[model samples]
Target: MWEALVQPFAEFGFMRRALLGCIAISVGATPVGVFLLLRRMSLTGDAMAHAILPGAAVGYLVAGLSLGAMTIGGLLAGIAVALLSGFVTRVTALREDASLAAFYLISLALGVLIVSTRGSNVDLMHVLFGTVLALNNSALILLCSIASITLLALALLFRPLVLECADPQFLRAVSRLSAVTHFTFLALVVLNLVGGFHALGTLMVVGIMIVPAAAARFWAISIGGLILAAVTIAVAASVCGLLVSYHFGLPSGPAIILAAGLAYGLSLTFGPTGSFAARVHPYRHADA
Candidate 1:
């Protein structure tokens, strides 16, 4: 059974591409996701995930199924949504959360309409459901390139990003780098979302981005521990999902997402981060 399941990688180019893409996305998404969870901006990442559909639709219209065109279009749309959300919060009485709600709904609706106008439901399925087995080398390279850049940027900005997230006021008072930090993270997020969306689709991208990181938080106290755990969980989810997909014919993207979801669920229920599991188990009481 194991040989039968694993045999496809030795023969199919697309399957090979899918496996590598999944690995890249898994490694890339969790670190930023953990930070987003820390900042209470999980919703922002969710918003970005939804925002991709429109970007994808526009990309399809602009250049068919080409990965580069789709990625560029998605990045532009992702940035636009982020900027608009920022603008509405600043200019109006509406709070940041409320502005995000409005933008998320608007972007999703627009994406649906654009995709509908351009192609049939089948094409929409390609954008939304995704075809991991259909991934080409071009798409795989795009995902890897985006992930590499994201990883580099995050490494360089790790200190400031964590500090700024913890206290924007202190950062603002101490360093003029605050503004650059804000948009730079968002820009990186845009790239990550675009790259990841092709694999997980909008609905499931947040899982890839956040679930592993959130899961890892349950077991670790330090940022480094958290990041390492998140990476491990992300990789595990990808490899596990790929195996499930190969053997059982599950959809690779959602299979991986569901795998991530399982990790998050387990962590949430049993993790030390005040999850339901912690409450039920009462580690302190049990130990005492």
Candidate 2:
């Protein structure tokens, strides 16, 4: 069993790359995502995820699955979602949630249509479910580069962006820096999501960005603490998921998601903040 477990790592280059790629992505995505939840922007991650399809379709027709082409397309599609949703609300009376909902549905449909016209469902499934364990060396390099740039961008923006999310009005009035912070964070999200999609696929990568953060919230009551917890969960899940699937012959991407889900469940059930166990503390209630 041990040899079978370690054998894939040694023999398969793709498996090695997949392991490293998932860890890096999880590290970058967890922090950003935790705050997205804090900001009530989880749905935006969902929208950006599905929007990858149309972008990927265009890229496929033009340059096949080349990472440059796909990343460009995914980046554009993600920004377009942000801008369109922002535009609708700025111009009309609709709530941001409603505008984002409309944008996500439309982008999802358009992506499907484009894919149907030009590509196979098999390719779509590969993109949606991921080709992580099957990645070429070029895809690995591209994924690593995208992850690094995104992490670097987030490191620069972390303080201002967190401030803006938690206290947007204060930042805008006092620092005169809200616009810079907001747009820079959005751009980093674009980079992160695009990079994550390469491994986790379009729709499912949202799990990478959102689940660990959701779980981390159970243990974290502050921005910095939450981010630390989320990154911890993300990396643990990534490593465990890859090993579980590699040894057991399960698909790699979904395994990572399942591991994340387990973390989320444990946190919700037992962590300190709003945990079920925390809420129903029998000993405390007995004293009362």
Candidate 3:
């Protein structure tokens, strides 16, 4: 059993790189996902994931698989979509969600068209699905760097973010940091999504951000507990997913996400806080 688990990472450098990259993504993206869940913007993460595709595609067109180009392009595209959506919401009758949806749809179509015009089906698949097992030194560095930045940003934004989550009106009334907080958080989301796409691709990257966070909700009531639980679940899913992929010859990105999905199913069924089992069989309190 130990050999089965340990031998792959022990023998393969790419496996080790993939492991480290996925762990870093879990640590950074999961906390942001917790807040996204609290704010009821889970789908927004998916939208933003797609929003970055055009930028990354542009990068690929310009530089042909250069990590620096794709990363920058993705960041720019994500930030543009986020800011544009916010701007539309502030200035027009449409809500932020609607505006964001429109932008992402357009962005997605544009990205796919551009890539197809310039590249082959294989290149399209690489842009859409990523190649985690082929990560080099630069990709690993990018993942680790984004994770560190995300953790620091989350720490600094925690208090206001919690306030924003609990009561946006109250946060706005009490502090001038509401807009600053919201936009900065969106930027962090974009950053992490950019990092994640390098490993999981735009299609699967949102799973790492959102699924583990949704699972953590079943197990944790407090914000800190939710963040902690999410990080833990994401890391475990990454490891298990990598192992399954290595042994079974599966796609690493989907394998990791499927592991996370399994965790979500289990949490929904058996978690202590508000699971299906808990709903059916309430815990009894002793008479006072």
Candidate 4:
């Protein structure tokens, strides 16, 4: 059993690279996901993931399989959607969710159309599904670099961002950091998603970002605890999923997300805070 578990990673350089990339993504993106959950912006993260597709497709069209072009394209596209969604929400009667949904749907269609026009289904699958087991050194470096930048940016932005999440109006009234915090957070989301795009693909990347965060919600009470729990869950899922993919001949990306999904389901049923079992057998405080 130990050999079965340890041999693949020990023997295969690609497995090690995939593990490192998964850890990098989980460390950076999952915390951002926790914030998204706290701010009720989880769907916004999903929308932004889809929004990057067209840009990535354009990059593919121009520079076939070039990581730099795809990353740049995804970053540009995600930021554009975020800004446009914010603009529409501010300038019109439509809510942010409605605008985001509209934009992402259009973006998804455009991305698919572009890919279909110039490439085969295999190419489209590569864009949508990713190639985790085949991560080159460049992809690994990009993931690590993004992880470093994301953690640093989040550290600097932490207090203001917490303030913004807790009370937006108060944050706006008390300081000029409100819009700065908002846009900066959006940029981090885009940056992390772009990183995830290379490691996991546009479709599954948001799962890596969101699922662990969602599962951690039931386990953590404080923001710091939440971030820690989310990252831990993500790492565990990545390991399990990678092993399963190796043993069962499953797709690595979906296997990872499915592992996360399993964690989410277990959290829903058995976690400490808001889980089904918790509600059924509520913890009783001792009389003071």
> How badly does each model clash, as a count of residue pairs?
1, 0, 0, 0
What TM-score would you give candidate 4 relative to the actual structure? 0.97
After superposing candidate 4, which stretches have Cα over 4 Å from the reference? Answer: 284-288
lDDT of 1 by residue, 205-263 (tens): 77888889888888787888888889888888887787788879888888988888898
Question: Which of 2 and 3 is ahead in lDDT?
Answer: 3
Candidate 3 lDDT over 44-138, as tens digits, reads 99999999999999999999999999999999999999999999999999999999999999999999999999999988998898898999999
What lDDT score goes with residue 147 in model 1?
A: 78
Whole-structure CA lDDT of model 2: 0.81
Task: Return the TM-score for each candidate structure.
Answer: 0.92, 0.91, 0.98, 0.97
Please provide, for model 2 over 99-141, each residue's C-alpha lDDT reduced to its tens digit, 9 standing for 90 to 100: 9788878888987787777888887776677777876677777
Compose the digit string of candidate 4's lDDT tens values, residues 1-288: 998899999999999999999999999999999999999999889999999999999999999999999999999999999999899999999999999999999999999999999999988998898989999999999999999999999999999999999998998998999999999999999999988988788899999999999999989889999999999999999999999999999999999999999999999898988888879878632322
Q: Rate the local accuracy (lDDT) of all candidates.
A: 0.82, 0.81, 0.94, 0.94
Lowest lDDT block of 10, candidate 4: 279-288
Which ten residues in a row are the worst by lDDT in model 3? 279-288
* lDDT of residue 286 for candidate 4: 31
RMSD of candidate 1 to true structure, Å: 2.2
Pitting candidate 1 against candidate 3, the one with the higher TM-score is 3
**RMSD versus native structure for model 2:** 2.6
What lDDT, from 0 to 1, does candidate 4 have? Answer: 0.94
- Give the TM-score (vs. native) of candidate 2: 0.91
The alpha-carbon deviation from the true structure for residue 94 of candidate 2, after best TM-score superposition, in angstroms, is 1.4
